[model samples]
Target: MKVLLLGSGGREHALAWKLAQSPRLTTLFALPGNPGIARYARCLEGIPLTDHDAIVTVCGAEDIDLVVVGPEAPLVDGIADRLTAEGIPVFGPKQVAAQLEGSKLFTKELCKAHNIPTAAFGRFAEPAGARAFIEAQGAPIVLKADGLMAGKGVIVAMTLDEALAAVDEVFAMGVPGTEILIEEFLEGEEVSFFCLVDGETVLPFGSAQDHKRAFDGDQGPNTGGMGAYSPAPVFTPEIERRTLAEIVKPTARALADAEAEFRGVLFAGLMITSAGPKLIEYNVRFGDPECQVLLRRLDGDLLALLEATANGRLAGHDVTFRDDAALAIVMATRGYPGDYGKGSVIAGLDEADAVEGVTVFHAGTRLIGDRLTAHGGRVLNITALGTDVREARARAYEAVSLIDWPEGFCRTDIAWRALKL
Candidate 1:
């Protein structure tokens, strides 16, 4: 089967890698793909993703059988709806369903209306109203932009000053628009749970713990993802069962009841606390570095699974996983999630991949002639799989140590909480 994968990140790279391994795959193509993904798929450039006509033309020319969107931006922009309208089999939710990630306010309301377990939140369109609510909510509240801000929209404010500052920063910055959400902070360990839902059937994928902090010891500003490890120790079998019963199932049912019938990946960001697993937020697409690690652990035919979900036959498909754990450490350009330089030549990638079980997936990198250089905030995702989290961490870091890129940095402890156990 011919496949056209979208986006140019570590998630797309990993998806390309996994999809390429499928025996059913006859051809693979990535739009605006990075240098790393070029190894497994034919990288195409100059195709404007926002242009639905251009995308349709490319799909027709390439004879692409399946279209897999990796990022939330294009999905929220109605890429899937456009493609599906042309009878193209696309693996992503439609634009209406994408509102789950595009607008925090919409998701909060959906959860409230459906009685889904989530933090109490209030939407504010004016700064004055937001400030007044923050004052009443007290410290340690979660302030978020209603619209997407590339994963940096939400702030877990620990103080009243921080909460108020975040409100001003998001609104005054004029980046997140006029709306913001003030949510009651929930105490718990965060876990990313993914599922493949085809209208009614929900197939559980693996879970991972994402380190959002840019620095080690969990101290820094939030990033798209610094690093991640799969088969999260926190999400044990028992917790998985409870989460599915009390959280995931309810969410899927709620969306169905609302006539969304969410298809493609349903990423539920959960906080497991004394009160059990409560939804922090919902992402319509897959998580970046988490997808990198989870894809590394996937042992079945990815193409078949995706096709089943797209065809609304996921109930009959068997999605299996390997018992091994996987870890992905993201190598980011210096001063990421803010200002940073680009085009610095990177080296030692071959040496990094020489380590057993390590696969380096590119995120923000480009090939200039023969030299690989940085292009975005996060650059490379070095992912590894092993029998346990400790081995996976060791293998992943061993690869990181060999990489020679002074312009880049990564979190040394990717999944310390899970590995320590």
Candidate 2:
């Protein structure tokens, strides 16, 4: 079977690596894929990823059997809708259904309408209204932009001054002045839970804890994700059961009733609070860095699993994972999620990959002649698998140590919480 993967990042690179491993795959292509992805698939860099018509034409010309979307941007832009309209099987939700991630306000309203447990939130169209809500909600509030902001849209304001400033900053983005979400902050460790749903039956995939804060000890602005580890200790069996019953299932059911019939990976960002697992937000696609570690632990044919979910025949199929733990350390350009230089030559990738159980997934990189240069904020992800979190974390860091990039920086503590066990 031929497949076409979408997006260009560590997540798509991991997906490409896993999909290429499937014996059933005969050919693979990536749309605007990065240098790392080029090793495993034919990358079409000339065409833009968001050009739906061009992508549909490529699928037709290449005789693509399945289209797997890796990022929320294209899916939210309705690329899946165009592909499915042309009779191509897509492993992503339609644009209408993708509002689950496209709009923070939309999901919050959905949770309220369906009685899904989430942080209390209020939508605002004016700065005054938002400020008023923040004043009422008090400090330590969570403020989010209505639409996607490259994962940096949400801000946790710990003080009234910060809350007011956040409101001004979000409004100043030139986004719809009326587009913002002010909610009461929910305290606890956050977990990234992935579920494959076919608008009917749901298939549980796996879970990972994502470190959103950019610096060590969780004190800094949020990037897409700094690092991650799988099988989060906080999301126990009981908590998983409760999350599915109270959050995942209900949301799926609600989407179905609303005629959305979600057909893709439901990335439920949850907060394990004192009450239970509460929904923080949804991504509607795989999480970067998390995908690097999660796919490393997967123990089945990824192609078959995705096809089943796309075809809505998940009843007979089951997804499994290795007992071993996995960890991913993100090696990013210095001063990431802010002003930073690009095109710095990167070195020692082979040495990094030579480390046992480590696979380096590229994010923001480009091949200039023979040299690999940094191209984005988060550059490469060094992921590893081991008997436990400690080993996995050690292997991941050891590989990080091998990379020779003076312009790059990474957190020394990737999975600090899980290393305790």
Candidate 3:
């Protein structure tokens, strides 16, 4: 099958790599792909994902069999709806269904209406109301922007001053009628639970835990992700059962009832509190560093699974995962989640990839005349597979040590929670 994968990040590189391994794949193409993804698929450079007409033209010219969207922005922008209108099978949800991630208010309302387990939240259309709500809720509350902010919108304010400031900052974006969502903070271990949904069927894909903090010991500002490990130690069988029964299944049923049948991966960010798993948030697509590790532990054909999902034939198929653990440590340009320089030459990638069971997936990088240079904040994902989290962490860091990028840095202690457990 000929496929057109979207996005230009580590997640897309990992998806391209795994899809390229499928024997059923006749051809693979990527739009605005990174250097690492270019190795596995034909990179269609300079084609912006927002260009729906150009994407359709490319699909027609290539007779693309499937268009797998790796990022949520395109899906939330109705790219899948566009492709489906042209009779092309696309692996993603339509704009209405994608509102689960695009609009925090929408998800909260859905959870409230459907009784899906989630934290208590209030929606405010004005800054004064939001500040009042924050003051009433006290400290340690989560303040989220109603719309997407590339995973940095939500601020877990530990103090009253911080919470009030976050509200001001969110309103300062200047989008009129922008709603601020203040959620009651719940303390627990968080895990990323992913499932493949084809409108009717919800297939359990896998589980992973990612470090959201940018620095070691879980200190520093929240980044896209610092590192991740598969089969989260805290997401046990019973907890998985509760999550599916109380949260995932109810969500799928609710969306279907609303006539917005979802088709793609539903990434549920859950907090395993003392009561049970509660929804933290949702991402319409797979998580970045989390996807890197999940793909490593997958034991079946990814292309076929995605095709099945797009066609709504996922009811009978089941996913399989390897027993071994996989870990990914993100290497970022120094001073990430903040201002940072770019165009720094990076070297020793081949040596790093040569490490046993290690593959460096590029996130923000450019190949400038045989020179790999830093192009974004979060750059390379050093992913490795091992018998356990400890071994995987070791291999991933070993590869990190080999990379000769002076401007890059990564957390030394990944999988710290699992190791402690």
Candidate 4:
């Protein structure tokens, strides 16, 4: 089957790599793909992903059988709806279903109404109202922008001053924060749990832990993702059962009850607190570095699984994952999630891939003649799979060490939490 994958990031590159391995795939194409993805699929440049008419034209011209969206922006913009309207098969949530990630306030309200386990929050459109609520709630509150901020919308304030300042930054500073949701910060360890839901039934995928902070030891401002590792040690079997019963299934059913039949990857960012597991947030699509790790450990035909979800036949399909653990360390430009230089030449890609079980998926990189150079915030995702997390971490860093990009840097302890345990 011919497939057209969307987005230009490491997640898309990893998807392209995994999809390319499927024997069921006859042809695969990526729209404006990065240099890393070019090795596996035909890169179609100059076509705007937001342009529904143009994409439809290309889908017709290329005889594309399936369209898979890799980013949340396009999904929030209703690209899937447009494509499906044209009789095209797309693997993403519709705009109505996408509100789970598009608007923080919307999801919080839905959770409250449905009794879904989540942090207590108050939504405000005006700064005065938000400040008043913050004053009542006191310190250590979580302030989040209503709309998407590329994984940087949410702020965990440790003090009252910081909480108020975060509200001001999102509301008064006009940083794409017209509305904000301030929630009571829950103290706990966090884990990312994913599930493929087809409105009626849900199939839980493996768990992964992502480093949202830009630096090591969980310091610095949040980026898209610093790194990630799969089969999170924190998400034990009992925790998984409770998460699916109390969080994942309830959220999926809640969306359906609200007349939004969600179909696609449902990413639940959960906090396992002393009280219980609470929802941190929800993502409509696959997580970037998380996708790199999960895809690396995936052992089945991805194309078939996606098709089943898109076709609402997920109940008949059971997704399998390898028992081995996978770790992905992200290599980013020096000053990422902030101002940073670009076009610095990168080297040692082949050597990095040569490491047993290691796969380097390109993110913010491009080919300038014969050299690959940095172009975005998070540049490369070096993923490795092993019988254990320790081995996986060792192999991942070993591969990352071989890369000779002076302008790039990565966290030395990508899976430190798991390793420490």
Writing each residue's lDDT as its tens digit, candidate 3 over 108-207 gives: 9999998998999998888889889888889999988877778877788999998888888776643577778889999999999999999989999989
TM-score of each: 0.97, 0.98, 0.98, 0.97
Give candidate 4's whole-model lDDT. Answer: 0.89
The segments of candidate 3 whose C-alpha lies over 4 angstroms from its true place after superposition are none
Model 4 clash pairs? Answer: none
Candidate 3 residue-wise lDDT at 359: 91
Cα-based RMSD of the predictions, in order? 1.4, 1.2, 1.1, 1.3
lDDT by residue (1-421, candidate 4, tens digit) is 9999998999999999999988889999999899889988999999888898999999999999999999998999999899999998889999999999988878888888878889998888888898899899898888887777898877888888887777777774334536778899899889999999888889988899999898888899988999989999888899989999988888888878878889899999999999778998999999988998999888899999888888888887877899999999999999888899989999999999999999899899988998889998889999999999999989988998899998898888788888884
Per-model C-alpha lDDT, please?
A: 0.88, 0.90, 0.93, 0.89
Candidate 2 clash pair list: 125-178
The local lDDT score (0 to 100) that residue 130 gets in candidate 1 is 91
Q: Model 1: residues >4 Å from true position, as ranges?
A: 173-177
**Model 4 spans with C-alpha error above 4 angstroms:** 172-177
Alpha-carbon shift of residue 207 in model 3 (angstroms):
0.7
